[model samples]
Target: MAFVILKDLAYQYPSSTGLVLENISLQIQEGEFVSIIGPNGAGKSTLCYALAGFVPHFFKGEISGEVEVDGRKSSESTLDEWALNVGLAFQNPFNQISGAKYTVFEEIAFGLENIGVPRDEMKKRVEDAMSLTGISDLADRSPYSLSGGQQQRVALTSILVMRPRLLVLDEPTSQMDPVGTREVFGVVRKMAEEGMTVVMVEHKVEWIANFADRVIALKDGQILIEGKPNEVLTSDLLIENGFGISRYTSAAREARKRGLWKKEKLPVTLDEAVEGFKS
Candidate 1:
């Protein structure tokens, strides 16, 4: 059975007249890592919200059709209840930080404390999550004292400590430097390997190619393409629609026209580009 099922899902914000999403249907199996790619205003962020149960519940929007996660219908469950099954981490980690907390550790534990988790278990969960995200050393640092990347790690650790079955990420590494971006993506990949489902919306085509099990491209709130990472990321439709692809893919496409690249399929990463050109 699919862990996340969205059938004919449509949503429009309270302030907006038109739907942000329309007839969006998809099924994500347990432990799958799905990456969503789209141009600006294509409703990628909105789709992440729907997966995280913030669409109709938290956003108070007009929603139609079904959104079910781990067999629980989003409309049928309260926001509080949905939190146990889905976690959301977005682009602005600074906004996610609770200024009331004195230290990073406290901030990470805030969610668990509010949900009435036992103290002993809460501490253990936070420790594990920090370690998983490679932020254990920053536990005692002030949340405001950290750099943008470190703060993003803390934001993600805060959500991860909840042990939600499904994690929804919308450009979680957008603010991070290259090193920090890799560190955060490492944690995300590890979580999927350990059986947590993840839906990530990212513009980093190379990272998506490396980690995502499947890729879905969205256009105007509807699915434009859905398939293996290699297929969707390198498809001509994305290029025509003004979606960004890997630099390697772009260069390879140009080279192919000049009869410089003999490969039938374009490469999405540097390694593939080198091999494709050599062969």
Candidate 2:
């Protein structure tokens, strides 16, 4: 069954702007790892909010059409109810964390606790979340004391404790260094492997290309293309639509220009490029 569904979704802010999303339609199955990639203002984040039921609930926007999560309409649901099924992690980790007084364990437990999870189960979930994210060693430390990557992991663990059916991450690794990026992606990959539905809005094409089951490219608030990672990542349509191509694909194109590689099929990863050269 489709876990999340959007049919002709449209949203417009109350202030002075036009529709941020227009006639958008999508369906995400349970345990699918999907990534939405586009340039700024392509309505990627807006779509995320729309799917999470934050568009009209928190943003005071005019929304039309239907958005259903597990067969419940998003427009009629409360944010609290939506939180139980969809966990969202924003671009900025600082905004997601609570006050300085909350320790890492307390912070992770806060969500499950609010939902009235039993104390023993809450504790187990918190410990499991921390362990899965590799933050169990820092459970006693203050959230403020951790490094950027560590803090991001804490934020992720907090959401993981909720055990939502769907996870929506908006550029979770945008601010981190290379090591931090890898750490967070590792957590995401682990979650995906464990059968959690993940829908992320990210510009890091190179990292997500190998892991994503499907890629959706948005341009001017519309889906420009959607397909497997290799097909979508190597398309000239993505580049023409202003969605950045993978570095390896660009490198392969350059090699073709220099007469070093002449395969008809474009390579999306370095390994594929190497194989193409060998063939």
Candidate 3:
């Protein structure tokens, strides 16, 4: 079933004269891990805001066409109402953290409490969320005192505590180091494995190309190409759209130049590239 749907969607800011998104149409199914990649201003974030009900509600914009989450129209819903179903994690983790005085556990439980989940249920949910994000050890620490990676994890746990059906991550690992980036991606993959639909906007093609079930490339506020990671990452269309091929894919291409790998299918990961070498 389609968990989120967009049809001819476009958004125009009040102050700007042009559309941020132009004629976008796509459907994301339940429990799919998809990545949206593009240059800086390719409407990637605009699409995220539109699907999360932030464009028309929070930003002063003119919206056309239709956006639906689980068959519910986005225009008919408020940000607060939609937030229960869609969890958004921004690129800057520090901007999302609130209540600096609260311990990590309290921060995670705060949203659940506001939604009127019972006390016992809230406790279980908080614990489960922290565990899933690997932040159970930091539950008693203050958000300000934790490392940048830990803070990001806490922010993620807060969202996970809400038990959202769709998780929208906007460069959630953009600010992290190599280790932290792996940590954030690990958590994201685990959530997807557990049946949560994940739509991420990321610039790190190498990492996402290996894990994302589907990859969509955008250019100048429009989708340029989309398909399985191997297919989309290897296409000339992606290069034309300003998306770099994954390192492994590039290596495979280089190997093909040397006649080491005769296979026509491109590799999307280092493991696949190594396997190609063996073949």
Candidate 4:
């Protein structure tokens, strides 16, 4: 069985007339990195909430079907219990900052302190996570005083310190620049390689194409396509449906039509495009 499984999952908010997520079913293997992409209001964030056990547990909504992670069902577990094995980072880092902490180190250590992790162990974990995200220098700074990208890194570090089995990220690098984005993606890729299952909602097609093990495209609260990143990120269907795609894919498509590109598959990353164009 897969490490993460969602079977016929559907959810609706109290104020909404229709389901926010419908007929969603997916299986993710242990240590796999899956990326979700779609336009606004596609329910991508809602799906992340469901995976992290906040859909019904915290959102107070109608949720049907199963969300099982490592044999424990979200429906059966309390939010606190489910949170131990799943960590979620929001798109906006400000939403994650805890005002109670005076320093970034304390902010990142809050989760560990909550579960009564030993003081020494918590410090070590927080320090390790900070270093991994390249935020060790910001350890003493106030969380509120940092820039958007810096805060995003701190938020991600906070989640990383928990060492969750599954990590759910909703545009975690949205506030970062190119260098920061690459660093964050590298850290996430490393985490997946080290046996963490990851589900990320992001619009950075090139990075997703280069790093994610699989791609799932959502539209209007339903999955429109699912496949390898090379196929999904370059699919014409994505363009037809108004879904975001890699710019290299777009350029390669146009070049192909002009008989300037002869590749059987379109490129989704800069390197692929350069190689194909040079051929």
Top lDDT prediction, candidate number:
4
The TM-score between candidate 4 and the true structure equals: 0.99
Q: State TM-scores per candidate.
A: 0.97, 0.94, 0.91, 0.99
- Estimate, for each residue in 155-215, the C-alpha lDDT of model 2 and write its tens digit: 8788888888889998887877777677777777778888888998888887777678899
Per-residue lDDT tens digits of candidate 4, residues 1-279? 899999999999888999999999999999999999999999999999999988988888899999999998999999999999999998889998988999999999999999999999999999999999999999999999999999999999999999999999999999899999999999999999999999999999999988999999999999999999999988888999998877788888888899999989899999999999999
Off by over 4 Å in 3: 177-180, 258-261
In angstroms, give how far residue 255 of model 1 lies from its true place. Answer: 0.3
Per-residue lDDT tens digits of candidate 1, residues 144-166?
99988889889999999988899
Estimate the lDDT of model 4. 0.94
Order candidates by TM-score, high to low: 4, 1, 2, 3
lDDT of 3 by residue, 1-279 (tens): 598899999899888789989989999998899999888888888888887788888996899989888989988888899998998876677878876446999988878878899999899989998887778999889888888777877777888788789998888777668777777777888788988999999878778866788998888888888998878878878766667677777777788889977888887777778788888
Q: How far in Å is the alpha carbon of 10 misplaced in model 4?
A: 0.7
Local accuracy by lDDT, each model: 0.92, 0.84, 0.84, 0.94
What TM-score would you give candidate 2 relative to the actual structure? 0.94
Clashes of each: 0, 0, 0, 0
lDDT of 3 at 27: 95
